[model samples]
Target: MKRFLWILFLGVTFSSTAQRMVLKKGRVLDSIPVAHNATDNFGLYLPKNYDASQKWPVVFVCDMKGDGLNVLENYKTSAEKQGYIFISINNLTDTLSISKNVLIANRIIVGASAIFSINPSRVYVAGFEEGARFASILPVFIGNVDGVISCGSDIGSIEILDAKNPFHYIGIVGKGDFNYTNMLQTENVLNKLKFPNQLLTFEGGHDWPPAKKLEEALEIFSLSSMVKGNNPKDKSFIEASYNASWERINSLIYSLKMLEAEDLITQTESVYPRLVGLDSLKEKLRQLKKNKIYKTQKRDENAAFNKESLTRVDYAYYLEEDVNTYNFKNLGWWSYQMDELKKHSASPNAIESQMGERLMGFLNALIQENIGTLKKEDPIDEEGLRFLWMLKTITAPKEYSNYLKVISSSAKNDDFGTALFYTEELLKKGYTNKSELYDLKDTALLRITPEFNELVAQYLKGARYELPIE
Candidate 1:
């Protein structure tokens, strides 16, 4: 049999069992059986479009019920464009999908680094409803995951998403989805827990991801990185901007974790903290108390929806209380959208880019403040600024030329240490720190451009230190 999942991606992506995305196909490992008389299909999914020239980041998806590959199948092209490798653990039962998917996500990550050119630091987990539950509590299983994304899942009632590691997270759901109430609480819990994540709500429920939501999901996925450095500016603005981005990113992550806990697991095992947050919120934010309830509902504002089939979601069953699945039909609140949520956000990549750009942007704003201060004028509020130089950093025409100028100028001034720092920044693909060494050999500086000379000089100067690249 071709299996139930292949049909889900029918006519969309090819199903060549021989092709791979990130994992070796037909490679068996420690067994994870499904049920009596049925052996579990434990393997990897290496997308057909994957390229091997450079190391790739990995995204591990749990809840592969034959359709485990469906997530990556249609989206491999998009993911590959970002240089990411997608891996899925299939043959998961709906009942045990979370647990099994977690185990596989962890196992492949450990092996991926050794077997492939996978960046150990850039690993991530993703899931849906039940699958999302597994993705939500990921910190409980692995010590390091770059990011997470979940939809319609049961995020257990716990503070499993550790705040220290700084993982990225995002949640997507229909306002009236069958599990909508749980999804809302999931966000509340995340806000309390302070995980770095984002939330995007649509107008439908308990169904496969609608096409419109996919763009937001991809935006979150792209934002889940840890590249560092910021534009040079007066110190205070740089510090404040980076700090705010950290705060916002961390809160969103906590939100996504909670979303997963609600949909993926069999129980609401760790929701007490969320209760505490709501209690605290009532006192701090008066408007939030007005509703005293943010459970998922049936009414929708989404233009692409079927209102006749939708139902209203009103119960907060997955709160600091009980857990129940409105499985028989469309759960009341988990079926539709809120027609009036047209808030202005940036472009698709803006949220993702903001994580880093804001830091630089903040730095630049701070520079502006400092410049004004030097001119004997008023300064800018720290919170009012949010910007980043990621695209500008890449597109600047004088990027390399300026690098040489800065390094050459620093070196001629005899600032060896500063020169070394700049060259290394380029080596690490980091921006900000200017280098001083632009031209140096054992006997004389090279005739190359200042930027190239700086790096070459540094390498030869400390030929013993042995920097990467020739």
Candidate 2:
């Protein structure tokens, strides 16, 4: 079966000579046509030193929005530094089913291999956010995916993981990201399944880790390749990486990030066991574990994690109840919850603050998922949808679209009172596009209402319609 899949992936052919003629090294080339599919294309980046004489490791990047060139640019520097060929699929999107996207990814992979001298043993995949979630699952459908560098996300589904077909999984996430807790939990599961995995965290939110962090991931991949005998070992490279790991460990300790320091120590021990001794790392970890500050920080973090877990359950339960019941009356209660989250965010305890932020992000994502699913229902539950959209205005105040949806949907139902309320609320949140307000969908009559115009005049100081003084 694997052989057949391999044949299927490699069957598509491109004129290698012609591709090589136009392709430039050390630059991101956009819109390279897929061999079998004319509509599908991908972005590519070859290291400056790339040559067909030797097989090079490749990282297939998945961008959920299909903006391949832009996503490729984000990873180009790390790929260039690590001598890995980087390619991004231009047609993969979250809107498409996972099966369809995986197929699209397979075609791009086939085209890339046909055009470049790719190292089959060292082939990997990477992505950020939704893209990361997609990349995490690709190895299941595709053959020979050696590793996955998932940024800001965890595995697509733990149930799909197989112990026999293990792939090196490297997750890079921010401490404040909603997925941070999920990644940590996933690491525990991966460890039990005996999958070679590492979770790297930074002090930030749910976005791409810095370029240096990506370089570190590539370095880990390189070190793993050496350990597996897939690449020739370089003593200098191993020592340099070892020294850098120690430096990072110490720096993390100095910054009072005992958790990160411990994680790095564990990762260093795992990657360097073959090339280096374990005595120093073991002793350092023992000492760090005994430190009073480390103990306190670990305790606090555990407490916060427990609290966050319970909070997540409450949020999930309540959100489902509210959505199904069209509990518009509970909107005020949701507003109170948001205020409490704000208070937690401002707490002096860093862990608590981060937990608050994660909770906020989690609730927003939950609401968004509910809204998306609700929109796809056969007989669209307009009331339920409106309630979720109204709730979204509370959960994600800066997201103006939800407010607009509330206005449009409410107006469609002839509830101008709700429409006028959201209009003023949207304006209060700094929405200044008068034209968009006037042109809102299903608000043809509502937009011209005296109430809507008065609210708009009050907030924006200008209304399209001038009301007569009665």
Candidate 3:
């Protein structure tokens, strides 16, 4: 692996400065100032048993919004249990470019390396959502990022990956997450590049995996370290992780999640081969594959995946067309598509139901991306913005903010009809904050109008203006 020159530079310049600073163990230490740049800070978690005598593996946890303490707290349990030093960047911002964020992350890493006894060969980065994407990109630029724990996201940029400099890529995502398919696809790409990678899926949606799942990820890192001779073999830890894998596999099988169970079994087989015997695991996998129920479940899952792929293509094409042309008429079509997704969610077949939930998540995510792009336009595409806000009202009715945006924008354009129509729609969806309605931006005329007040009164029963005996 190429050397991290940045670390060498910081080690020379900041080591003396860092020697004077004391950090608390067994608790999160927030706002530890970077030695070179005191204004920039990071959160750190030293294991309770941490000692300067031995180097420890470190995981740099990224948070785009820089809620360092919260992100550190979330991973502290596993880090503590696994004896890994955890650090969170406290100044990362999504508003900045990726390059800028990478610079910020580099500074944090430099600071941490200067202050802590971190094993350079076992350094890892981790995060969820956008932060996870950022973490995955770090190994491409910064040398010696041993692995990445990407939660609910895929690689930030696959084109930039160097095949010769592959790192262990461990992705944890939920079955119902929109990024689930993306992570699986990324795994295929990593395999083509011969990158060491694994994808761990759970039974939930687009959120951080539970602590147990994170512990499993850390365990994999530990096992990988032993395999590469970076860390001494710990017999007790290996046996415990092996036993946990079997218990999880059994639970998954008992729950009839055949595919998930099979995936876990495959992962266990790969991780434990060097440390323990795998004959039992291999035979178990062989028998599970031959089981009629497992075969049927696998077939149904593949069919659902095929169906979801086609549906996703349709959604992407139509959403692009709808957004580009400001196709207000197609709003009904989008509504109908959402209804179809709801029907799929209500299906008796578990795989089909999961496909429905995933599709809905994908559509919402796609729409959000379009919305973000339109928001960044120089002139602020009002027509496109209005169309998306209108669509949001249909797809996510409970999101009252989009309804207000639609009403405010329509009124700004002097389209009182559109404004009043959404006013009633918003009220019909249980919006009762009359003060917010009256105070909405660019809706002064619309809010006081008889039609708006009448609709508000009809739904919420306390409009500012009376309907005059109608």
Candidate 4:
């Protein structure tokens, strides 16, 4: 009876690790001076099927909300389903400090290796935002990540990565955000440095894992590890396989470069696809048979989804190929472009507090230049002035939507005269939104003409409904 009880307890304990995710149960090493107390800690996830005897590849994932362990859990299930070890850790430093990052990463890695049987040979790092930047540059500071996968943040370092130890990189970014520039630039530098890398861009704003990118990355992993099975292969067979793989890789590069060169086909004064003559590219690629293209090795659509780079109207023009007109152009991967943006990326002081300022600088000009003509003369100029003034009421970033509070209280009283001045300014500017006109409609109800209402309603839904004026 005693033996049976002990056996039951051991089985329960052993199988507890079989669940899809193992959470923040790993060892924590807090080397930071201030975090000396119990607060200095992190987490790791060992899958349910993880065995002490067999070694598995490692993938380090970092997230936003204080390590946000869920990302690890998600990646763990994904890795386990593919037979790999997943390491998730939290950064003690609130900001970007490389030395401390290395310490925390090494601690979890050492502990994971001892207990989880992690394969030291095949380690990968992945993260989002600050976490993404950390994982991307891990090879630079932390020493041993076979490859880096970045989801959302800027890598911040590509100049240091060259042919010597350039990491196999993969990035997924949103097309509508500033960081998409980073993804574009990383691809170029990786290609130039001869590092195997990919970037996928999606039509998103700010953040994404966006189903398609996961599929492509998984495909990259599988193709990258095709020869892992230890069958009865001898010296000659291994040599032949390696040679054949290089040939295939060379062919793919030749094709990818040719495709990238396609940008030369379309650079008009208008900077967009005219959707007409690109037949010249076929001849161009033929002439430069050295052109390289990516060839998908697997049939798995999930693994083939290349969302790291987006197909924007103005796809990047690699400068190495075009030396004359594009000297030191800020195009291509984020890491490379960030090198260009270093001065801009510097910590914001009052001088740089205006970085986020995208408001039209001409708003004040239009208000002051035409305020007289707005009230007494041309109806259109009067309309433009109203918009310019109302725009001034709003602050940078979070535009002032609460016009009720933004305008003077006195404006609410006398025929909303001040409000009328603001509304008319906007219309005269040649850009009309149904939303802004409708906002001032109740106060300046007399100015709400059908033409004005129609234009605003066309672009901004419920602009007319907000004030309920026809």
Best-matching candidate per lDDT: 2
Q: What would the per-residue lDDT of candidate 3 be over residues 300-341, giving only the tens digit for each residue?
A: 999989999999999999989988898999998999989999
Tens digit of lDDT per residue, candidate 2, span 79-132?
A: 888889999888888889999999889988887888788888899999998899
lDDT of 4 at 408: 30
TM-score of 3: 0.91
Best candidate according to TM-score: 2
Q: Which structure is stronger by TM-score: 1 or 2? A: 2
Candidate 1's C-alpha runs over 4 A off are 1-49, 94-101, 224-470
Candidate order, TM-score descending: 2, 3, 4, 1
lDDT of 2: 0.88
- Lowest summed lDDT across 10 adjacent residues in model 4 is found at 1-10
User: How many backbone clashes can be found in candidate 3?
Assistant: 0
User: Across residues 81-145, which tens digit of lDDT does each residue of candidate 4 receive?
Assistant: 55555656655344646777677777655555555566665678787877787777777776666
Clash pairs, model 3 backbone? none
Q: How close is candidate 2 to the true structure, as a TM-score?
A: 0.93
- Give the lDDT of residue 46 in candidate 3: 84
Q: What C-alpha lDDT do the candidate models reach, one value each?
A: 0.44, 0.88, 0.87, 0.47
Candidates 2 and 4: which is better by TM-score?
Answer: 2
Query: Which scores higher on TM-score, 1 or 4?
Result: 4
In model 3, the Cα lDDT at residue 266 comes to: 86
